[model samples]
Target chain A: MKANLTIISILAILFSSCYKDKGNYDYAALNKLEIKDKNGVINISIIFGDTLRLSPEITQTTAQNEENLTFEWMVFDNSPASSYALPKTVIATTRNLAVQITEPPFVLSQNYRLTYKVTDKRTGVSSFLFYNLTIINKYAQGWIFLEDKGGAGDFSMLLPNGTVEYNVYSSLNSAAPMSKPVKLEITPFQITDDMSPSSKKIYLLTETDGMEVSYQTMQKKFNYGFLFYAAPQIIKPTRHTWVSTSTSATLSGSLGVVVNDGKVHTNLVGGFPGSKKWGASLLSPAGNLNYITAPFVAGGTTYTAAVYDVLNKRFYSVGNTVLSAFPSTASTVFDMNNVGMDLLYLDSANVVREYNAVFKDETNTPYLLKFKTVSTTGAPNLTLLKTQMNAPDIVNMTAAASSTLTPHIYYGVGNKLYRYETTSNTTFPQFTFPAGETVTKLKFSRQPLGTSQLAAVTWTGTESKVYFFDVSNVGDFTTYTNVYSGFARIVDLGYKVP
Target chain B: MRSYIYYFLLLTAILAACGKDNRVMYKEDPRIYFSKFATNPDSTDYSFGVKPVGLLTDTAYLTFRIMGTAVDKDREIKVTIADSSKAKAGYHYNLGPLVMPANAYEVRVPVYLYRKPGLKDSIVTIDFTIEESKDFKPGYNDKPGLNVYDRLHYKISLNDQLLKPASWDSRLALSFGVYSKTKFNFMIVTTGKTDWNSTIFPGDQNFLIQTVKLSLYNYEQANGPMLDENGVRVVFP
Candidate 1:
């Protein structure tokens, strides 16, 4: 009882101390930060490689003084405000704030907020001024065609202004000659978390050396959550033959990179998974990841997805579960595209897959082979559909209506377009490109709201031509319109919705 | 300690309530009916055209299904033909009687729609209804996917190939490239009359593509592509 009374006395004393008010004081600054730029707002527009200089005037009341005050001018990409200890966000804290827009973090048509913060050394109070700059580029929107100058790759942008700029990468990065650019992937043309404007992100995955340009940008911000390395986390990936990215069925809204590889990995970067790739969970058998490489194609629904392994000659796709391996008999998995449930990959046989709801995903969905040699009635020559896809001339596939409903995938065989039927394992010869020209790349420009325009780059001995066709009709090359001509060898083509 | 035990029990009860209760109670027997998808094989109108040079006929089968329980006794239901001016039963076509046998949830009725010139100057509907039977009453009716005709009654017109129904274009079947007759016929029978209208967008086309494409047609029983009116394999590209 005596011990309990002693504890009660201590509790009463603590409660009384909590109610006590030592003193009340207002240490907030009598100062205001003012920044002056081009317009009323402190927002300026700067193109790539353009220098920005700003000297803002600070206003203060009679109570405030300039002595014993410190000024910090920092640059950040949408990072929250902070006080006390400075975040490693000092882009340029040198003698004077002269931003040398030489590298990335300086992406075209993007907004970067510049913070001019002032702190009173005595009061420990800070005032910050946020100013943003819209990074602009002459070749901002439209189709970007990548060219391979031997092993070193360069890109040309077909601007909305109807002019194709020859070397866009060279103007921004002087080291572009050294880095071998393999494939370039941009964030999906959808509304992202930060409502970031389109064309703000363009990831140029290269072949080794310095990460200087992109590395410095990533330190301050996570743009579109997309990261590329000739060497990424865990298994370093590069020199991939085929690459595709789509919204992950496993991780909603997030984009996953599927590559035809010695090891197929979807854990690269983007929305659903910020930095962590969700592909490692797909491993059931040891080294099963090796069987799935390259030629990753997106199926409409998660149920009809096709991830073909050219090396193992198998399919590693996702169903209700992240299926590590489905011993698919499909021998030659051709270009996999998704228009509803249309299967793009065909063996030597061009067999059709019936995306049975019972068996979602591309694996084990009933298959049909309508070949001249095979009978469609009995067992459908399951062995043949797995072994061969009939159109031998099929070098590449470009889907009409990119990511649109009722889209059509045109299989470019030599010069003819073989339209594949997902439900019936058959291909109908649609239209053919002009003579002496082989399609180097087939692409589609995504129009806003599920609309798409089809375009293809064809090459011959000395020239490459880009042709535009109406993808409005699922598979019809008859609507062909010549977009551009006379380029060396078109390596890759990416279209921004105009 | 006693209060904590009570709280844990309450939480456990709430969790139990949230769990899936697949337990179905036949509180008085829930009724059944012929499925709307079951009303038409491919959910397409029974269409045909008389060949001028050759004598031809087609007999497509429509399915009968019980919605509630499978009975042990054989049940025969009466079907009354809709007496319209365009169609006469003995003149244009012959439809066999429908019977649900012992312990069966499904059965097929042969709806023989024929096109003999002078049977009718134009297309005609061979509409019918499942009258109440001694063994079973009208099982269950109101369904979402069923067309207006199939929901309350079963109807198929003796439509000519040239005068096919306008509804065929917007069908869920078109998503699977069934713009032609043979593909349509193949889609229906191969699917075994599963409802497509209700589950079109997210629905599985696998059974139709994978299994049905490989199955021999009940009427043709051939192992090749289904050709269109042009005599070429129907390629809707």
Candidate 2:
């Protein structure tokens, strides 16, 4: 009880002293202004000016003046003030003051004002000033087309709302896109075709009434008004053969690519009036019409395929070489050297060997068929690679190059795909696609109980469905979770309800 | 020593008198009550307050008063309706004049607490047999329809292929020979709709589907059904 009395006595003494008058003084200030824009957004910055003596009562001692200065800043108006600190701002002790006005919408050509005030604490006097600002709008605006027209085959572009416009090439150069692009207005189109096929170029035109038009030259009896729907279709060219006078025909095969024993085989579609044809060619022992050789030029090279020769230790390709021997029928030729192939199948080299499929890139730049190394293991590892004829777009691959080594890969080149073998280390034996042709669709399939096979599909006309057998399994791969299939036409859209 | 003791006693009395002044100036006695003291699930936020029409009527209110002494200690004063049987889940307004003398002040706000039934109108009420005081009288006022649930919403998708003959005419022709029929898997889904059986959960509902068949004769009878008038007569021939 006695201790409590002592504490109460001390508190009583302290309370009386709290009300003592120490003299009246006021110290406050508002300062500098700054403005900034972030992508058409505006912001403001302000800094407090140096302390000023507003009254005569303040000490004028030069040496003590600096240490005695103090200031408090505030924002006033209908706007509520905040204690949030701005950049470079600090508790004022003379040369302190800065504030930032965050970005907010402003009238395009309206003037805004910020008010500031300052008071001398020692003298109890104050002064005020206001700064005015104006805001201006900057101009930034262009149209962009998503699809380019130079590449082989036809494809459609889709708008954000799912409207589609088909793209068909009439020639290498055209000012405006063909106004008669196929109209795919239904729900997102689905690929009814089961496999990949060959690629062909079809000229598209718009009639006077805006209907999609393609040459129906396939009829035995050519006549006008032969109505047929230009269904989106993929065709694969298996081989090139001379039809009647001035006509070349292609046999159509499956619409996908496949892989077997590490060798690559693709389904090819043959075409007339440019039809997709399916066939295979290997050189016979005789070196006439079957083997052709020429100096490997940097450009103008076409048709690359892998052909295994059971008779020789090497492989044959229709590249950088003339026909050494010709076969009258579609026979499996087994002699590699007779066909003028410089390099045969190297059983242990698991490196990708590419063939030039198309001659030019989107910029019309010539490209080459070159193979870099990919993954390799076990004896006789194989690597079959396909690059987009004119680009480096590569896909549907197997057995990558060793992780330690990076392959100089290309895109949008022949096929934009490849097949590599882990056992033979070579491209599969097969015939090549004709010049100016591309394998747009490469799909692989396996029956529920039958052996797995490669299907190659290609786009031939404005609308052509073609399929082929992929001797070289390239594109079109199926896994437990995903099945990659090609559509007759460029798939406009796809959606599935849960 | 005796004189020193007296001096200390005098100082102690002065300090005690000052402390008493502080305590007496800050007394706390808070009271709360609802204007309408009944517990009902259909209660709205404003229902507890007296209505304008009842201005002259003597209204009985449930008063919750809290009395305190000296220092302000945190306390909970709960005002619950003893008739738990009629209790339902809903919004209720608690009324308060909440006044005290200048020395008596409140440090915290008063709150109301009540439990809600899981199902709508599912709680069965047991009559309050407990007798009411002779001076007490139950309050009465107008009542509004309780919005048990918002209007039900329906999503309908029609498939003509599945709705063929009965649900729809595929060909849309009134001739028997030309009559074409298709079927559709009509799916009718409902949400926020009233469940007559109250089998559905409080806010969830299931979808329903019913298939029907259509024929040319029936289509003609309704409006030149699947069979035209002439075709309908030809069938008799």
Candidate 3:
């Protein structure tokens, strides 16, 4: 019995070895049988190269019944360090012998690969195959930047790498560049200019070499002081302080600088000090302080003040009303109700209207008379005139016609700067440059020379230059050309110039 | 021999009676399905909450009962908010496996996932009112594009116009939170509908899931001070 057991063990081993011993029967026979191996099977194919179709090519072996034999599938990653089999569900069909992979779709801008394999169930045989697969993603054009100067920031720039740089230009000087660049990191860059003051393209560029260039569109200019803002400060060259009369003053509203005791303080005149404080009230009626372009008293009847509620700070005036000076503010000074109350000096009949209220004349034309009512019906009969005179060529009056007060009209008729008096329809003043250089800024001046008679004006004639003028005297005030040359433009006055 | 024969006949008769009844029976009551789930009240959907972001102390009991004869007691709740088709999907709530106890009773548990940066969906209520949590931090940046979507309940102010200063990037941030029937706490942070939020770091007690978008100076025209007409909208999970 022992001999028989040993002989049987050897025979069994011999039988197992004989199966493989056929000197490797035609690889064709293995392919003919259905594979049913406990180990897995894997099939690989090029799913889409020439035409979106998986082309399976068996390279290592030739099969006699390749078409009749069913290929059980499995897969292994050639690149991975450890051997990995495809999820059991990976199956291949006879139709194009395509390998199907089941998995979630690939994410955008991501990479992934799926391997397919197959094996024959009838014969305990299997084969391995694989192909590399990858996915690509699309890009987007993301962001842009814009510039603002008015209420908005100075210059908004969108960089190539999707960052925004904001540059605040100090002034519109051709020589000065904006302040330091503030870098803002962002994607899909974009910007807006609505924050800018003027609705125009404003830019400041500094080349690699640091050369700077600034540009702005030109418009009519005015002298601030010579206009209606000058009043009440006329001390007439006090013995203590040197009377440095100005030949030019800017008309840039009353928000400029006030020099006090050698230190600059904001007068807060007409309101906002431009100090970057949020919600600063300028010329608030609640504050009991109102401001207007021109304030004057004419006739014996001290006509009401054409006070502009500067707090609104709008180009167009809305609730502009005229009222008498409440002794609480302006002191009891001139007898404004009398005809001697020269509110404005007209170049034509030399007449002045004291209370230029909102009104229409006999011709139903809106005129800046002492007491008149303006109708809000049809277009108001108001026209833009040149030269302050009653009769001059009518240019286009861009503002609303129904406005009864004299519009602050500015125009350059040759070298002279003329401002129309709304209250005194016929009279307007001229800002004459004593020298032949280009005019720079028009701003309102603080501390009028002769509170009752003079208005200040400032202009630029040359580089590092300044000129000041006082147009208070009654003569041909237009003839004072040499006064501006001698007067210095109040150096370091802290006035914001355009 | 006669005595043994008598005993066998008795045993046969008893076995015969038992064969008549095929169905199995039990004296105990069947388990009924209970709908109430756990709630984390302190865990808000707000990204940057008035309080710190972390595990919430306030909790509500969550219990369920099965009323059928079957022994099956497994339960799962799907929590998700509506999302844009383009954005990848995220999980809102998932309550793992729980075995029903012999007796029916309520259970209170703490909320874990406090906040994230996705939209909020219905079903999960943080408190009484179903509101999107505030989770965005406001700041300025330069990327000019749409940012992430938030899923907390929040009220939008339509009257305020979106205004970005020129020459400077806008600074914006946002935060929010969500409630979970399964998980105790959930939250998300997103770019608030308005472009007024920036990215925030981890350490400073933040549980709002959110994302940030940047741009140079978009909200208005190129040269004047004005705001755009784009309105604010919130996404829900």
Candidate 4:
């Protein structure tokens, strides 16, 4: 009887639990959203100044129409993590995104986080999709030519892929037309305190003034007056160069040397990024004012910059602030402190620590002075090779360029280019331009491995042309690789190194 | 079962140990002392000689810092001149009223220094000490083991003389030629700047050099040739 009662109680409990308890519960399907790029790609790349257009396919499971959803697109800088917050910009509020990219190009391809958000208005639920966007600089790596369009200055670029861009400066900066172009330089290092990713600067020097512009966008940063802590009263900027020094095994910096009105001034570059303005004129070893005639400096180890003093008619090596003359040891080669000839051109040679300078005596006899500014022991090793050049037309040379891989110096006279060998004292004709054309500028590409390429510019009465030649190992013009025409007088050409 | 109960109690104790701490920190006594003037504490003395370029007076700020938490109300700080001070309070210098503003951790007390005629020949010094005030007491002293005299006491010396600037040798000599009292005075008169240091930007230095050159040329045209104190004609490079 007890077993029967237990079994009946268990059956009663099971039946009671099985009875349906009706409650106010409702069933509804959730609106699922799926978003993807039209091509199923999550990474996109576009050049600066180009239009970025993206169309994404959206799918919703519910019956709600696309009109019931709101879309938003945002772009944020996806650079490496920093102490400061990155910037975010809302691009569009529509389903499709089509916007012009106006951001500054970095030294490297800049990454940007592109987010697309869709919201269901009825349910107030948001769905987000992210994409990796890359922005490349259009004028990132190219050959930049500063030319004189009529009287105003403009810039032209020849991309590595044989694309030519003309009027680049005027097209970007219409309001501020550059003056008569004199020189163009690129400092491929951090110079200012802003710590920008694209810290490289393009220095555009005119006849009467100069200005620093962005290497990527060609936008003006500051004028020549601001380049100095105290600008000279007479602003006749001739040239600018950089001297890099490694203070420690891991720490390095550069000094920007500018020759203005025959005076040399220096400003710190790299190392601790800050507003380093050019200070007073560098003094001579005797603690007196001196004038530098050469626009270019032959810089070597430990900030040793060899410059020619027109006033003293000597070669002085500049170290940070002052100029020190070479040792007065009498040598059969030549006297460094008494190189009584006028300096025609000065640049580093193809050999390490060797500088090649072209000078002319009172009789207009052209001579080549090759000397190492410092020896391996950091002492003055002045004389290397001093001989009279066999090339007679070198006195009329208008433009000159040298390479670190050859012992020959290339110079231009009128429409003819000649190569003078330092070892044999020989002259050879390299190339010739069209009739009535004069070579305006010649520069060997300073890129580390691309030094074999030489860029030569020639100007006729009304138009200019630039020619690129592949130089042989023996300093001979092997091939005419490329030529660009329909340009104004190109005063200077520089490579925007990557 | 007993082991299970023990393990449960151990887990509960470990979780309780992770609770947020509510204990308060110990506070130090509210005190004040004269702070070191420069970033380097070893640089204790603060002295500046007035250049002989018509600068009649100058002001120097003596900074003071607090030791305790900041309060909302302004606090009074007592500053007294030591007996070894050679500068007369009324004639040579006048110490301004000392008060730390509400919630301020540091205060800069201004002391006005006069370029009296006697300073042209001799330098006068003033030693300052922080004393006990109504709201705060003196801080870090020169105890046997304590290294706080640079913060507890300060001294200032003033003078008026024509001294050669340090940068004249390295930088200014190239633009302005050699150093001379007459040339330096001419520079001061032309540029209206008594302080010519390395901080002066190159642009401003060039502008000043040009201005002085022009002024010297005009002065020579008006009053024959401008001569130095030694009766030598002043020239610029």
Q: Which residue pairs show backbone clashes in model 4?
A: A229-B202, A229-B203, A230-B202, A230-B203, A230-B204, A231-B203, A350-A404
Instruction: Give the distance in Å from residue B88's predicted Cα in candidate 3 to where it truly belongs.
Output: 24
In the range B1-237, model 2's lDDT, one tens digit per residue, is 654565588678666767644345763333322222123222222111112222321212222222344233333333233354343313222323323223332322222322222212232221111122231112222232332311111011111111223212332222212332111111111111211221222111101100011122233356642333344322210
Clashes of each: 25, 160, 172, 7
Error of 2 at A474 (Å): 63
Least accurate stretch of 10 residues (summed lDDT) in model 3 chain A?
A236-245
Give one digit per residue, the lDDT tens place, for model 1 in A249-290.
322333344342244434322333122322322331232233
Sort the candidates on TM-score, descending order: 4, 1, 3, 2
Error of 4 at A98 (Å): 12
- Candidate 3's displacement at residue A63, Å, is 99
Q: Fraction of native contacts in model 2?
A: 0.00
TM-score of 3: 0.22
TM-score of chain A for each candidate? 0.51, 0.19, 0.21, 0.75
Over A1-498, each residue of candidate 3 has an lDDT whose tens digit, in order, gives 555565566558657866755575555433432232222323222222222235455432445545534443333233332235533333445424343232333222122343434455556565544444332211111111212222222332222243433332233223433222211111111111112221111112111111111111211122212211221132111000001111133222211121111111112122221221001112222222333322211111121112222223211111111123222212112211221211221111122222223222234333333331121235222122212235132132211111112233332232345555443555354555445543333222222244111222333443212223333323213443222222222211112111
Kindly report which residue stretches of model 2 are placed more than 4 angstroms away from their true locations once superposed.
A1-117, A124-498, B1-28, B33-237
Q: Is candidate 2 or candidate 4 better by TM-score?
A: 4
Candidate 3 yields a Cα-based lDDT of: 0.26
- Give all candidates' CA lDDT scores: 0.48, 0.26, 0.26, 0.75
Comparison by DockQ, 1 against 3, better one: 3
**Cα lDDT of model 4 by residue, A55-156, tens digit:** 888899985569889999987778543323766778899989988887442223567888999988888888888998767677777888899887799999
lDDT of each residue in A1-498, candidate 2, tens digit only = 675676577568758888879778695443322222223322332211212121112323222343434444333221112223432222222333343332332222233443333444655444443444333221000000112133222343222233333432223124333332221111111211212111111222122111112111100121111111111122221111111111123223222111112122222222322222111121223321223222121111121233333333233332111112222221122222332222211111212232222223334343222331221233222223322222222232211121011122211123223433322233322223334434543333322253433333334434322233322123223322221222234311211100
TM-score of 2: 0.19
Alpha-carbon runs more than 4 Å astray in model 1: A1-133, A178-182, A189-201, A205-255, A258-261, A266-292, A297-306, A318-323, A326-403, A418-430, A448-451, A473-477, A496-498, B1-237
Interface RMSD of every candidate? 19.8, 28.9, 24.0, 9.5
